[model samples]
Target: MKRRAQGALEYLFMIAAALIIIFLAVRYLTRTSSTATDLGNSTLENITQELENAGF
Candidate 1:
């Protein structure tokens, strides 16, 4: 009985740790993607302005 309890606890701990890692990874990915999108938008705006100024 004691062994079974210990095994269950270990499994629970591993699962919790895995969940935390997954959450952090997802958060990081979302932040990175948003930053990339913002950068792309700014770059596009700059290009448009430059082109308009050059009468293109």
Candidate 2:
């Protein structure tokens, strides 16, 4: 009976660890994507302005 309880606890711990990892990964990805989007927008704006200045 104690062995069964130990096994269950181990499985629960692993599940909790996996969930934490997944949540952190998702959070990191979202932040990175948002930052990348902002960077892309600024780069596009800069290029547009430069092109206009060049009379293109």
Candidate 3:
């Protein structure tokens, strides 16, 4: 009975660790995506302004 409880506890720990890793990965991806989108938008706006100034 003691061995069974130990095994169950280990399983729970593994599951918890996996969840934490997955959460961190998702968060990192979301931040990276947001930063890329913002950079692209800023670049586009700068180009548009330049073209307008140049009479294009």
Residues 1-56, candidate 3, lDDT per residue (tens digit)?
Answer: 99999999999999999999999999999999999999999999999999999999
Candidate number with greatest TM-score:
3
- Candidate 2 residues 1-56, lDDT tens each? 99999999999999999999999999999999999999999999999999999999
lDDT of 1 by residue, 1-56 (tens): 99999999999999999999999999999999999999999999999999999999
Q: How many residue pairs clash in each candidate?
A: 0, 0, 0
Once model 1 is optimally superposed onto the true structure by TM-score, how far is the C-alpha of residue 52 displaced, in angstroms? 0.6
Query: What is the lDDT of every predicted structure here?
Result: 1.00, 1.00, 1.00
Q: After superposition, how far is residue 44 of candidate 1 from its true place, in Å?
A: 0.2
lDDT of 3 at 17: 100
- Global lDDT for candidate 1? 1.00
Clashing pairs in 1: none
Greater TM-score among 2 and 3 belongs to 3
In model 2, the runs with Cα more than 4 Å from the true position are none
